[model samples]
Target: MNKLIKKKIKMKKLFSLLWLLCVCLTMYAQATKLTVDCQNPGWLSNKITYGDQMTVKDLTVTGYINDTDIKFLCALIRDRALSGGRLNLENTHIVGSISILDDCMSNGWNCLNGDGHLASLYLPKSLKKISSAIGNISVDSLYFSPQKIHAVSSESFYGGDNKKYLKHLFLGENIDSIPKYSFIDCENLTSIHLGKKMHYIGEAAFYASTNLKHLNWNEFTSSLDYIGPKAFLNTQWKPDTILIGDKIENFDVSSFKYKDGCHVFLGKKVQQISNASQWWSSGIQNIFLHSKSIVPPHISIRYDELHYFTAYIPHGSLNAYKSDDHWGKMNLIEDITHVDSIRIFPTNIVLGHLGETASLSAKVYPEDASIKEVEWMSTKNDVCIITSKGTITATGYGECSVIAKSKDGGLQAICRVAVKESRPLTAITLDIHSLQLEKGEQRQLKAILTPENPDDSNVIWSRSNDNIEVSNTGIVKAKNEGKVWVYAKSTDGAIGDSCKVEVITHVKGLHIEPASLTFKKLGDSFKLRAVLDPANATDTTITWSCATTDVCNVLEDGTVTAVGEGLAVILAYSNDGHYPSTCIVKVDTSTDINIQTIDYPKETQIYNIEGKQLTKLQKGVNIVRIRKGQVRKVIIR
Candidate 1:
C-alpha cells in the first residue's frame, strides 16, 4: 500500500510540471501579439504571470481601460520600453480622473526600473483631467490631442531626472497653460508645441532644457495673457524670434530673465510690454508692434535702456508710440507704411517640359524698409515642391499654387503652378493660314497641337494689333478695315503659325473727273481721274473703254485719246462697284477752223456731243453755230 501511494504521488508531480510548461508557453504566445477584448480578457492573466518582469511584445486592449488596467499595462510597457514601440490609445477610451503612472506604482511597478521609458504614450481623447501622481515615464516623442483634457499636474511630464528620452512634445489646442517645472532638465528635448489656446506659463515651466530650441510662442492663434516668474530661467535656449500672434497681455518681472537675443513680435492684441526685461539685459534687438488701434499698449521700457533696442509700429501709430505714456521712451521708432505690403512675381506658370524648374521672388514695398525676408509654400506637395527661398520643382502632373509670404506676417502672393508630363508640345498648326472677311465679320480659327497627344493640348488665341479682336475660342472679329495677324499660342509658351486676316471694305460708288471731254482732232488725248465715293474703299481698279472704237480710245488711267474724228463716248467702270461713269468726246476734223477766235451771231447756237446748248465756248472741241442749215465743228483750245 505504501509503494502504490509513492507511485501515485510521483505521477501527480509529473502532471503538475507538464501543466506549468503549457501555461508558460501560452503566456509567451500572448505576449508576442495579443488582442484582449472584454469578451476574452486574457491580458489580466498575463499581468499575474510576469508582473514587473513581464516583457509584453504587444498588447491591444479595446473598449475601455481604467486604473486597474493601467496597472497591468505597466508590465506591458516593459516590452515596449525595451523594443521601442508606441502605446497608442487611439479609439481606445480611457477613464478620466485617474493617474496612470500612480496606478502602476500602486500595483508594484516602478517607472525608474528603466522599463518606463517608451517610444510614445498617446493619451486618449476622453482624458479630461490628468495627473502624473509622482511617476516618471519618458518617450522619444509624444502627441496629445486635447479633446476634454484641461487639467494637468506639475508632475505630468516631469520625471525629476529619470526621463532623459523625450525629444519632441505637441500639446493640443485646449491646454491653457503649462505647469511649473513641466519641462525641466529635458536634456535632449528640441521642440515643444504648446498649442494655440494657451494663455499662461507657470514659473520655471521650461527651466534648463538646454537643447530646446523651438518653442511655439510664435503661433498666431496664441491668446497668451501671462507668463510666470523666471519661466525660462537657467535655460540654454536663445531664440532669434518670439512672435505672439494674438492677445498676450502680460509678462512677469523675471519671466524670461535667462532668455536672450530674441526679437519680440507682439500681435495686434498686445496689451503691454514689460520694461522688467524679456531680452535686452541679454540685449534686445528689434520689437515689432502690429496694433492698428490708436490707443497703444502700455509699454514699460526703461528710459535708460531706450537706446538698446528699436521698435516698429503701424504707420500712423508712431506719434502714439513716441509719447512717454506709450512706447515714446523707445530710442528709435519706425513708422511702417512701406513694409506693410508685398507682391509676388510671375504667377500662373506652367512647367511643361521634363525636369522643369522656376525661380520665384517677392518684393516688399518701399526699397529701404528693413525686415525683407520671404517664405515659400506649395499647396500640393505631391504635384510640386518649393524651397524656403522660393525655388520650385515640378514632381507630378497637376495644378497647385506656390505661395510666397512676407516674414512680417499678413501680406502674401500666390503663383499658380501647373505641372505637366515630360511629353512636350512639339509644334502647333492653325486650320487656316489666311482669312478674308468683310468689315464687321467674324470667323472661328482652329489650332491643332502636335505630337498629337501632347502633355498640354490647350491653345490660346491672340491678335497682334487692334485691327482685329480674338476670343478665347479663337473667334476672330474684324474691328477695322485692315489686316491683322492672329496667333495660336500653346500652354508651353511655344509659338505656332499665325492666321493673317485681311478685312476688306467694298466700293460704294465710282465717279470720273470732267463731266465731258471733247477732243478737237485725231491723235488728241486727255488724262482723267476716277474716284470712289468713300475714300477708304478697298478696290480702286477701274476699266476704261470706248463706245465707238474708230472714234476714240480710252486707257486704264481714264485717258481719252481720239483715234478717228467722230462723235464717241469714253466709259470708266469700277470692278467692285459694278457701275460705269461716261465722258463725251467729239473727235472732229476741224483743224481748219480756229475755235479760239470763233464767234457766233446773236441768233446762232452752239451744242455739245450730248446735244446740250452751250452759251460760252469751252476749251475742248465744240460745234459752232449753224446758220441757214449749215453745221460747223470747231476745236477749242
Candidate 2:
C-alpha cells in the first residue's frame, strides 16, 4: 500500500507542472494587440497622455501601426516635451522587431520630429532588428541596450531633411553588421562614432550624404567580409580620415568606386601588386610606389582587359621604384666625306682629325673664274681664319666653303670640319653708305663683309657710342641724336667699310584739286579743290579754271559748272609760281528721245510715230501742250 501511494504522488506532481505551463501559454495568447490612430488628432489626446506611464499590457501599438507607422510613431514621440525630464521607454515592451523599408528614409516619411529629443528606451534583449527606413529624425541621441541585435540596414537612422538635429548617433553596442544603403543620403550625419564592439559594414553603408564628414570605427574589424553594392554609393568618408578594421579581406569594385584615384591602403604585408593596373589607369594620373627591390624583367602590368604592358615607370621613379639595366643603342655617324674646292691660306695647312692628327692638304680650283677673290670659310663662316694669300687654319672643327672669284662671279667648294672650338669674330666690314637716311631715325648696322678666315680674325665689334647697335646681320641701330658711324671691325682690329647717313628733315609742298564735278545721266555741277605736297606744305591760295564753257563752265576765281554731257579737266594753280594741278570732270547728257512732227490740217489726223500729237502754230510763239505718254499731265510753255 505504501509503494502505490508514492507512485501516485509523483504522477500527480508531473501533471500539475504541465497544467501550469499550458495556463501561461494561454494567457500570452489572450493578450490582444491595442493600437492608437496616430494620424487622427483625438488619438494623441485621448490615448497617449504626457507622464501617463504604462507598461505594454499586450502587444500594443499606440498609433496607426502599419508599414508606414514608424513616421507617425516618431512624430508622436518627439511631440512630448519635458524640460530637465527624459522621455523614458525603459519598462515599455515592443513585442516584435521593427523592420523599415529603405525608401522610407528618403521619401519624407522619415523626416519626423525634426527637433532633438532626449529619448531613452529599453528594447527586449531578444530584439534582433529595427526598421532600416527610420527616415531622418531630429532625435538628439538614442540609448540602445538590446543584446541580440546584429544588423542595421543602411539609412536606419537617416536624417533626410531633419538631419540638422541629428548631431549625435548612438549605435547599439550589440549590433555588428550594417546593411547596404544604410545611412545613405543622410546629409546631417556629421559623425559616426561607433562602439568598439561593432564589426561589419554592408555595402554603400554611407554612400552619398553631402554633409557627413566624420566616421569612427573599430580598427580590429577592418576586414569586412561582405559589403553590398554601392554601400557607400552616395556618402562620403570622414573628411579627415577613414580607419579600416582588420577583418576586411575582399571588396567589390564599388568599395572604392566613387573615390577619385584614392588608393586603398593595405598594410605592409601585401607583396607584388596584383590587378593594380586598374588603380593606375582608373583616373589615377600619377602614382608613387616606394620599393627598394629591382623590378623583375618578366613582371607584367594589366589594365582594363589587356595584359603585359610595360608599367608606366614614372620619370621620378629612379630611386623610389627601382628597376634593372636601362638599355640603349650605340651611336654611329650616318655619312661623312670631304667637299671639293675648300679655300685656305697659302701658309696655312688644314690639320684634320684623321682619327689622330694628320695634315690633309687639299688643292682647290675656282669652279667659276669670275670670282675676283678666293678664300676658304669655315662651316660657320665666323671662323674664316684665312691668310691674305687664301690659306685656312682649322682653329676649330666645322664644315667650310672654299670661295673663289670676285663679287661679280665665283666658284666654291664645301669642306666639312668637325670643329671642337671657335675663334674670335673676324674681319667685318659695312658696305659704304650709298643711300640717305631720314633725320631723327636710327640707321641699322650691317656687317657687309666677313673675315675670309674668321678663325684668325679676332674681331671684337662695337658702335660709336654716339648711337648704334651692330646687328649680327651687320645692320646698325642708330643710337646717337643724329645718324652716326655705322661700321665693322676686323679680327686683326681694323675697320673696313663706312657709309654716310643723310637725315632729310625738310617737307616739300605741292597741291592739286578738281575745278568741276559731274555725275553720268544726273545733274551736273563743279567742285573746286586742290592738292598740297605732303613733304612740305603751307596755307596757300589756289585758283580753278575750265578749258572751255561749251559743255562745262568755270568761274575766273575757282569754280566750274557743267553745261552739257562731256568730259573736262579743271585746272588749278597757286598764287605763287607753285606747282599747278588739274582734275577731270564728266557731265551726263539728258536721257530723253527727240521727236519731229509736222501736221497739215487735211493730211493726217492722230498722233505721230512717237505717240506725240501733231500741232500747228502761228509765227508768234503759241502755247502748245505735249502729252507725257500714259498720263493726262502735259508739258506746255
On lDDT, the leading prediction is 1
**How many clashing residue pairs appear in each of the predictions shown?**
3, 93
The stretch of ten residues in a row with the least summed lDDT in candidate 2 is: 327-336
lDDT of each: 0.67, 0.44
lDDT of 1 at 361: 86
lDDT of 2 by residue, 1-637 (tens): 9999999999999999999999877655541223334444224444544323222222233322233343334544445332112343322333222553322223343333333344332233333444422343344454444565566643344433443445546665667677666666666666666655665666567666656555554343454444454555444452222333334444343443333323233322223333321432343332222222223222223333222122233223334333232201111111111233444333223444322232223344443222234444444544334444544555555545544332333344444434444344534555456434443454555554453544554434455555445654555444433455555556455545665544333324445553346655434554565655553333366666777666677675556666776787777766544567777777755332222343333433344335555464323222334334232222222
Clashing pairs in 1: 280-283, 280-284, 322-328
Model 1: per-residue lDDT, tens digit, 82-148?
3455566544554434334321222122222335656766665555444442255567777676576
Off by over 4 Å in 1: 1-60, 66-68, 79-83, 93-115, 157-167, 179-189, 251-261, 275-280, 283-296, 325-329, 339-637
